[model samples]
Target chain A: MPLTKRIIPCLDVKDGKVVKGTAFVNLRDMGDPVALAARYAAQGADELLFLDITATIQERKIFLSLIKSVARQVNIPFTVGGGISSEADAYNLLSAGADKISVNSAAVKEPALVSKLAKRFGSQCVVLAADAGMQADGNWQVYVNGGRKNTGISVLCWIEQAVQMGAGEILLTSINNDGGRKGFALSLLQEVTARVQVPVIASGGAGSLQHFADVFEQTGADAALAAGIFHEESITIPQVKQYLYKQKIPVRL
Target chain B: MKLVIVDYSAGNTCSVIFALNRLGIAPVISADAAEIRAADKVILPGVGAAGSAMLSLQQNGLDNVLRSLQQPMLGICLGMQLLCTASDEDDASCLDILGGQVQKLDAPKIPHIGWNDVYDLRGDLFKGLPENSYLYFVHSYGVPVSRATIATAAYGQSFSAAVQKDNFYGVQFHPEKSGDNGLLILKNFLNL
Candidate 1:
């Protein structure tokens, strides 16, 4: 079989606990990050991503501890993101046991950090997490700081530049579709996946198994990421993979 | 078993150590030639460009030490590529324990990340695992299927997912991060 499409369950973490919010607000405590990670691994999650929603310099130690604990138990690969502004932060997380470290607002502020991280670590270790929302002109604009500030930069152009700077993978979350559970932003994902050669992970707006299938079929996204759906137990990773398998979408089972 | 994960600072050693710890084996992470040579089983875990990884291995004199080891040595990902004669990633010469050249993957996507099935299993490394068992992979370069290849996986084309020659074995997939089946592969290697 070819490379199977990944089904990643994201854990939006705050302080040291796992939390989920709608469109990145009104957060609800899910559970312990380590416990949730073990559950996902047992359920055959392809990978896990922990987004430190409220990452502060003071909380770095807490987040690093969480990563170390998760790495000790969870056998699958996991990535830690949010507020990683420097090479030291990225290195600390990787050393703490994260398979990859994602950069977002930090990379937008310092594009050279992407290249530096990629050169120091391999491209495979750097993931560019882009949060984009549609603009009035019908173009997607890049948003940072948890989608509060719009950079007025075209999503396509920013993604292209980041990839050139050596980002190995693209984790694209449609700010409008996120936490809505309507469905993935197919058009945005389609455009980005088509433009990039690296694997594109579609995030946000995953309501059902059909939503997962649609994103994989309609767009060139290599993976689909959802937090609320899995956290709520509305649909499980195994269920999604089985559904995709029936749809003839290659998924690891 | 006294397992030692050869750490040349190539990355991902912590994951490997944690994986082994889950299996009840506390592997010693070391670059010292003596410690690695003394271990019953040695694992060479790597995650980075071949050129720099090779450079680190040589700088620590691990290249010669690894080439001379007689224990069951297993290489994962970039570590696997380094077991080959050479790699096209940085045009670096490898340990040549295995008979092949690591070349860039000829696929639409450069780094083929995610789970893929490994079939055509041939050695004790896959002892209890079924054919077409899924394993996680993340790399831009891979060693094409050759005489030493014990199992094969396809991205754009079939490449060596696992290879074995005498006491040395190499797998392009990251068993440390490949979930249960991956841990089984590591357990199998440990048993060997």
Candidate 2:
């Protein structure tokens, strides 16, 4: 049997509460992380991705608590990312209840961190979250520090290198399509999925249910992730799964 | 009934413990031989490489305890692979309670990190779950089907999704990480 395409709900967490923004700006509070996670899990979300938007040493302590509390409330696989620089951070989060640790800027700064976490905890636990945006040259560039800086690294090259260094899953978020709600960058997703064999999670646009179907049909991504739509309750997770099932996508309802 | 989750530093015991707690089954996470041996039901939960996990079990001397376990014991994920005779993961020799070799999956994906349906189930571990019910899986290596095979899944080839021999039961997927169907599987195991 074919592996079912996954529908994941991403929570952009800041100050221990779920938040969402457009074009990665003007953050708005959504709700408590623990409650939202429980609801999503019960709603049949295949997985949940928590990206800690807090960017401080002191606030990260609060974020850890949120991770622990949310993990306790849900049974599905969840990933924790944001500002994780070393193995200690990864270790703390995994022990706190995160099934996977996603690294973005830290991995871009030092690729060895990916290999270190993958080796110590196993590759299945290490996820490479790449934020890619369209460039004038018709190739995507990798963004670091939560889409604040461009590393000038080609997105395709970085994905290949990350996978080789032992990143088991790749959370590919298109910067240009992020919060745009128009659609996912299917071409970029298709390119990355073609380049790497690991499961790729396409994040960014996801305006309607059809977008999810488009990503799955057009690309080889194993999953699709969205934040604003899920947080705003514009469409419920079960609705998405029902739609996928009708489209013959083999979703777990 | 007392339940003990074998904790050999393989990682991700919190979710398993939490899931059992939600089911009203408070599990003790330990490497102590007496606790594991005395428990009514034991869960061997693991995540990571087989060689290192086996070494950790040996360091704690839980390897012998597991092999000799008479109570119904269930292994999840890497723990399931470790129940086999050996694995290509670091050329690791395992408990050998289930006579099969764990080999790397020959699939388009290496880790198989998503939900997949398990069909052809034939045991009490999956008592209430319907056929073709999806269970979350994340692993690079798996034990092939054998006399102990109870259920099988296909990624590129058919491998044991669930295995059984005497009172020993092992599932290649993570029931704790999986959703309600997974919780049902855990509930069935607890009842068994």
Candidate 3:
């Protein structure tokens, strides 16, 4: 049987509570991390992505504790990202209860960091998250540091490199479309999925269930991720899944 | 039932533990042969390369102990691959409790990661699970359908999704993370 497309709910945590931001800019508080996580899992979310917006040393400790508590409450695989620049950082998060460690800016700085984490803990444990924005030339450029720094690296080149370095999954978030509530960058998602063998999770503009269906149908992404809509309860995971199933998309009902 | 999850340095046993905990069964995660042999049921859970998994099992002397287990045992993902005769991943020889060998998937994707439907169910391990029900899978290698095969799934090709011979059972998917379908399968195994 073919693998079903996945619907992932992203939680951006600042301090200790989950937050939501627009295009990686203004942040707004959502709710408690553990409570929100339990809700999503019970709602039948395929997977969860936790991005530590503020990875301060103090916040890091709180985040790990949050992970420990959430792990007990949620019974699905979850990926954690933000400030995972070293193997030790990855180890700490994994031991704390993250199934996968997503590397972004740090990985672009040291491409070997991907291989290092993959070697220590199987490739399946490493997730390559790339923040990209479409350029005037119609090419997506990689961004770093929460979309504040443009690395000038081609998105395709970076994805190919990370996959070669042993990243098992790719989390492609379109900076332009992120928080716009328009729709996903279908062209960019298609480009990444075509270039990499690893599963590509499309993140960014997800205004409605139709937007998700469009991304899944137009692109080869294995999953679609959203934060604002899910956090605000504007759209529930079960609603999105039911929509996908009705659209003839294979979703776990 | 007394449940023991065989732990041979395999990664991500927490999900399995949590799944069981939800059902009110506090299972022990141990590599101890004595505890495993004495358990009413055993779950051989693993993740990572087959070579390293085999080496770790042999190093801990759990390889032979796993083979001698008389109770109903379930192997998951890498655990399932390890129960076969051998695997193409690093050309590692595994515990031959079940007939057939594990080979790398010829799919366009190397690691078949995500949820997929498994059909042709034929064992108590899949009791109450509808045919073509979805389950989570994450692996690069898998065993081909053989005489012991009770279920099969199609990726780039047909492969053994679940297998059983005597009291030995193996599933290529992660029932722990497969949501309700997974919970039901684990419940079936526990009932067995």
Candidate 4:
């Protein structure tokens, strides 16, 4: 059967500009997110993910308007997450042109909320975002509230519950390698992808095109999501796909 | 009067946009309820999980909006998956606009990623293309060959490479990356 491999560009939005950094802090401005999105869309990116890295519990509605504006400019599908709490909040993001609403901290707070949104909007809309920080014990621990607090649940187990509760996809981020250019934690990806039936987007630790190829080949992930490489223009989506193509890994060129 | 790229977050739409622009067409990217309905022709592009893409559509209240459109709508990749009744990705329940299910390839190489050919063509998207026209493809899941199928492709198994239903059409391959064949497909779709 024919299935298209996805090439996704991630934008870390802070006050409407795409930003990037290492280990989730000390961010620097990249460019206008809307323009970058348009540029990526023009370059053949499979999709775009907008992470409201600054969408603290305080400033939210502002993010929605940004999402709305960004949605208006581009013709491809985009996902918005960060500071999303209630069903209405998710609905608003969707209303603003967000094709998907990802739940991380909120889902951890009220585990049932995943099912609620999935039931109300269908499972496909709800994404379970698991921010994994490696513990001394070698377990990928789940973090919530913008990676400020650690949820005691195992990241793998939390993802499993989220799927059972009705999440359509899992966006897994590795704190150890996020923006480090050390490449993805294929081991962790192997663990997560083996268990979940849903599409798993491998985030964090992407420094090169081969990193993406390795993620799909080694971990069996459906898509590879990265921020810095794309934000810095280190590697373009077409470049990544073309690299994958040369490797005999099927991509849309 | 112009090519309209449907902005549902079903997958990567940029490739199509880039492809069209390379072919000298300035396509409009839209997700607004009104704009997409107003476009001369529409292309739905997608990647990622099928169920999530469907949710994105419904969350934006776009499913109904897309279903009611009179303009030609072309679904690409997972965008194609969303047109069906269901898909196995994330155990999704799709738009049911086209009666089919997007099933996982599940072969030894799980996500079948590579170049493949649309063995035979019978749709407007490939009007000037020849039989077994090769196009770029990279996916792990696919829509089963059904009544909607208009073209066939081979990877590990034979499946619906392209489909047409009413004004809605779908392609399993990425014509944008397939050189001249892809450009011709874009021209054909815009004219249809």
Point out where model 4 deviates above 4 Å: A56-59, B1-119, B125-148, B152-192
Judged by lDDT against the true structure, how good is candidate 3? Answer: 0.89
The models' CA-based lDDT, in order, is 0.92, 0.91, 0.89, 0.78
Off by over 4 Å in 3: none
Top DockQ hit: 1
Model 2: residue A226 alpha-carbon error in angstroms: 0.4
The list of candidate 2 runs beyond 4 A from truth reads none
lDDT leaderboard ranking:
1, 2, 3, 4
lDDT of 3 at B78: 90
| Per-residue lDDT over A98-196 for candidate 3, one digit per residue giving the tens place of the 0 to 100 score | 888899999999999999988878888899999998899998999999999999999999999999999999999999999999999999888788888
Using TM-score as the measure, what is the rank order of every candidate, best first?
1, 2, 3, 4
Candidate 3 lDDT, B64-89, residue by residue in tens: 99999889999998999899888888
Tell me chain A's TM-score in each of the predictions: 0.99, 0.98, 0.99, 0.96
Docking band of candidate 1: high
What is the per-residue lDDT of model 2 for residues B86-162, given as tens digits with 9 covering 90 to 100?
A: 99999999999987889999999888888899999897888888888899998889888888999889998888999
Write out fnat for all predictions, comma-separated.
0.81, 0.74, 0.57, 0.04
- The stretch of ten residues in a row with the least summed lDDT in candidate 2 chain B is B123-132
Candidate number with the higher DockQ (2 or 4): 2
